[model samples]
Target: MTTFYTVIDWLMVFGYWLLIAGVTLRILMKRRAVPSSMAWLLVIYILPLVGIVAYLSFGELHLGRRRAERAKAMWPSTASRLNKLKESRRIFATEYSPVARPLFQLCDRRQGIDGVKGNQLQLFTTTDETLKALIRDIGLARHNIDMVFYIWQPGGLIDQVAESLMAAARRGVHCRLMLDSAGSLQFFRSSYPSMMRRAGIKVVEALKVNLLRVFLRRMDLRQHRKVVLVDNYIAYTGSMNMVDPRYFKQDAGVGQWIDLMARMEGPVATTIGIVYACDWEIETGKRIFPPPPDVNIMPCEQESGHTIQVIASGPGFPEELIHQALLTAVYSAREQLIMSTPYFVPSDDLLHAICTAALRGVKVSIIVPRGNDSTMVRWASRAFFSELLEAGVNIYQFTGGLLHTKSVLVDGQLSLIGTVNLDMRSLWLNFEITLVIDDDGFGSDLACVQEDYIARSTLLNAKEWQKRPFWHRLLERLFYFFSPFL
Candidate 1:
């Protein structure tokens, strides 16, 4: 019996070694970033079986085989329809301002979508204003209303929006609502979706979480794109989820969330609607968007309209398009770069680019909320403050509210606004949408909004930042160490 027990122990040891070797070999073959790969290796080797389980659950971008094949199969038809939609709307090559041209060119070359002209934009900064405008549009919907959000917490003014959608459905309007399963876990657990479905609205959840299938994909992968298309004529996209600030996260003590949304019209809306249609089709296995009209509803009135390009990024895309666009924007900034986001934990390349931009004498400003809801995110974000401040980048902490807007204004000529944050999760994990606006008037408007945020914020001095508690710095460093994996 003693000999048999010894043999069993030896076999157990051999099995553990075999498992670790297999995981290590797989990680090496993946060819992820060196830092990321090293981090995973460290975790897998250090924690016995826990690290391997964690990596299996979270490390890979496990877009299911079915979804991957479906997305591939849908691309050709989607691309052709997108081209026809753009062409029918008379989208021409935009002569972007010199400062913004290269960024546009990069997106055009990679994304296969150029700037569409004659887009009229309205900027909304407050929750009341955005909700009112969106509800009004839904109320006026004639044919179709498509909406997607990362989160849709019920109650408050959100109920009004739901009522509007129900009324639109009653009026014979086709309505489709897509929500991220993980982000909207509360909503799905509640009775809202059933109510919407009973009202004849099509509600689909993207990236549904399943514990049984954890190894198949990362359960944290979220559909973070917030978009609303009404009648295929007007569109809305931004950092705002379908949650009212008053009722959402009140217990977190971060105060009301301040967000930014853009109400867009003209040809750009159709392009954005195409984005929605593609996502909707992927989620539902049904192509729902109607064919493009023979005649353009709105002609290209170049003199008075804004030129906008949509840059959608996710695991489905190639080469990290959004991150590249952001890097390009930072590199292209000749005068000033203003960025505002609730989360600021960026990858090494983006961090290096921003620091380099400031070191090269570009006036760089970063604005984040003073009180963050996530303790880990707060520490991770603050870890790089010393480096940023040393590089002469102006860092401000907004005290007014939880500044939830994600925007970047470059040289007062180009602006990027959408649901994407500057964090690794948003930049790498989540499906995000960004609108690149290359118009002087629109850039100026967004700049003014950012200026107001600055007015409400307190700028941090390098010396003062260094004076924080030692434990705080320790926590920041600890979290920063794990940021690449986060």
Candidate 2:
């Protein structure tokens, strides 16, 4: 009996190794030199079981047949609208800069969202302003309102917004709300969803977590997008969470949570509406009908000289458009590159791009929080800072508050702003959206914001970084090893 058991165990080990080898070979064939594919191959070779689990959780890109069927059933109108946008872009010969044009072409061809026109943008810097604007927009909803947030807490400022949404729903305004299952788990267990539902609001948890659904996809691929569309003519996107001052605790040592959110009006709003509709369709099998073509939507007027393109990325998509766009933009930067993000676990290609850009005489500056909520992520981020500093990149830590914004200003002529973070999850795993604004005015405005953050921040010299406690540095090194999936 003992001999038989030993033989069975050996067979199982051999089978596992064979499976890992086959999967690694398949991944290499599918993705040419993508960081994600390479990382998966390494993981499978170094740690077979963990690699297999990670691959199951995040390695697969296809959303499977059930999701595809549900998407088609729920959002037939949205699909039609996307087709129209594609047709429109093909007719126009809109030109983008070399760095951004490739990404635009890729998204337009593959994702069915075209570069829209006639849109006006208003940037909000503070949470107070953002919430006020959000409430005002909610109050102005005439037809329908669609909102998706990663975090939605009740009481205080968020409660006010929740009440406003409920009030609008009571007035017969069509309202649909989607929140991430992981990020908004607290709100899900709370009375917010039920209360909104009682007020005639439709609330759906995006990417419901279930062990049985493991084959469908890992629960870690969260919908980190924050989008609000009203009446198909106005939309808002940024990094602001739906919590109030109490949650961030500004009065405490946590500092203020600064963010950037832009309100857009024009044909671009329709594109944003399509994104929300897609998420809604994916979550619920019900699709919201888009507005008729005759709806007097104007072209996006240029508020500034900068041209802007919106990039959306996720596991459902074939390519990581935003990540590719950032890498391309960073490589294209001739003078300077300034970036601000809450989490900063960049992929190998992005790291090399920044370092190589700096080596070529381009000024590189990264603004991060002094302390982040995620200990592992912070440690992993620190492990890379020394190398960046050594490569002539300047690092700043915002001391006033948690810098929750994800933005990049390149050469003062281009700006990339939106909900995506500079982390592996945002790059390859999570659903993210970013707007590549080509307006000099918008870029200048974002640069001013970054400057202000730097003014309130403390610069970490290479000497100071090296003086940190030995154990702390060791922990950071240890965390760096697991950063590929973080």
User: Which one is best on lDDT?
Assistant: 1
Alpha-carbon error at 292 in model 2, in Å?
5.1
Off by over 4 Å in 1: 293-295, 299-304
Q: What are the per-residue Cα lDDT tens digits for candidate 1 across 229-251?
A: 88888899999999989999999
What lDDT would each prediction earn against the true structure? 0.88, 0.79
What's the lDDT of the predicted structure labeled candidate 1?
0.88
Instruction: Give TM-scores for every candidate, taking all chains together and pairing residue i with residue i.
Output: 0.97, 0.87
Candidate of highest TM-score? 1
What lDDT is reached at residue 63 by model 1? 78
Q: How far out, in Å, is residue 220 in model 2?
A: 0.6
Clashing pairs in 1: none
Candidate 2 lDDT (Cα, whole model)?
0.79
Give per-residue CA lDDT, model 2, range 165-201, as digits (tens): 9999999999988998888878999978888999999
Model 1 TM-score, 2 decimals: 0.97
